[model samples]
Target: MGNTDKFEMIANIYDTPERIQIAKVSSDAIRECLVDAKSKNAIDFGCGTGLVGMNLLNDFKSILFLDTSQNMINQIKQKISSSNIQNAATLCFDFEKDSLSDLHADYIFMAQVLLHINDVELVLSRLYEVLKESGHLLIVDFDKNEKIVSDMVHNGFDQIELTEIMTKIGYRDIQSKTFYTGSKIFMGHDASLFILDSQK
Candidate 1:
């Protein structure tokens, strides 16, 4: 939610072929890490247009598509309405600015969302509070990219450092892997993505 205005402006055209492909890969990576998900409810934090979360609807009992930009939430809402998806919902909320104490979930997965958060540890801890006991938090993001630089978003993340932060925040059974690589994915520089799985 760091660059809220940019995401709000691009919400209408966010679902490009490249992004769809990346979403598919990210969804697949998340699917592999799911266990007994059919009985669980999930939160797709920073869900952009519901691309990745839409692919995963059938895997979970319900999914809350959450984002900071209202336009992004509207886009996902339209998709849910047009498809008559019963198990999906959307919420336009920023974890950085506010906290939702009653919003609990069996699992929470954020695809390419962590990099947009300015205070990563604070957000991660907030998400940890929202999780049900023993719930899972799957994060799909880029491996640290030295070539790409920007003030709007993180260049990427280093998995080991991230794991340490999460571990410090009380996450366990953490595991991560680089799952996909694509051209000009991060700030016009070729980059690989990684998926990190941890339990609360």
Candidate 2:
């Protein structure tokens, strides 16, 4: 299935307690690396149901929740309406298809989203384009795993390899560290995740 259709099917069940807790963990990791956030614009590149992004609204001047699935964006909109949130908006957009040249951001956060993409380099290039000078990109994804296997998803990522790729894409001051591990966290098997923090 395409990214949109696959996420649309799971939008209803995305906010399970387990997922919410995990998202909190991820957001906390991202927050630790953020500096001067209150005056900046940030985009949650794959914000599903606004779990982490909404929690981070207080930190940024504006937060754009971007996702491939309209259904996922719908959930974010509902939360926005009920909570009377300000400085936050949802957009159903595909990173692969849409030109992000018009949208520049000081920070971008992607949690558990990159593994689903088949072309990592292309997406990273696009992210670099949209980032303002000296902007940061924080990516939360699984560390390399040998036990899990799937054609539709990357088994995991190698920190050194990813860093090399990011550097090649023109990112600077890149750093990565594993932050969380959970039982059956990914694909019904135990997994650990790393957060990659880099400057454009």
Candidate 3:
């Protein structure tokens, strides 16, 4: 199966305890980076089942959950309906094949999503375009790990290289730090997750 298909298959039960715990941390990280996001429009780019975004509804008044998988979008819709989450919305979107020219966000949160993307620079450039001036982009993903290699996913990333890419993409004040580590998280080996905060 492709990346979208594989995630779609797991949409129903994607919120495992470990994943939820990770999302909570990511939410907190975003909250810290964008302290006043409640007054801003937030986009949960590459959102999967709304775990990270939903947890952030209180912090961000309007949350747009965007994902490439329809099944993941369906699950987000279900969660919004069941929880009576009026401020949250879902969209089956893929920036790689769609346009974000009409939309802009003050805060863009991406958690555990970049490793699956093959063209990191292209994706970041699109995300930069979708952000409003002075907007904050929060990214939570695995740091470089040789033990977690995969054909369908990345082995993780180097923080310095990622920062350089963000700089080249016109983002200023870039910062990246590893905030979480877990065993058997990335391809059955211990992995550390880094949070990158960049200002547009």
Best-fitting candidate, measured by TM-score?
1
Error of 1 at 180 (Å): 0.8
Worst 10 residues of 1 by lDDT: 146-155
Candidates arranged by TM-score, highest first: 1, 2, 3
Rank the models by lDDT, top first: 1, 2, 3
- Model 2 earns a TM-score of 0.97
Q: Model 2 over residues 85-154: C-alpha lDDT tens digits?
A: 9899888888777576689999999998899887898898899999999999999999989998797789
Model 1 lDDT tens row, 108-190: 99999998999999999999999999999999999999888788889899999999999999999999999999999888999
Between the candidate structures 1 and 3, which one is better when assessed by TM-score?
A: 1
Q: Model 3: how far is 196 from its true place, Å?
A: 0.5
What are the models' TM-scores?
Answer: 0.99, 0.97, 0.96
Task: Write the residue-wise lDDT of candidate 3 on 17-121 in tens digits.
Answer: 988888888888777887677688899999998888988898877999999999999999998999888898878878766567898999998998998887888
Instruction: Give the whole-model CA lDDT for all candidates, comma-separated.
Output: 0.95, 0.91, 0.88
Between candidates 1 and 2, the lDDT winner: 1
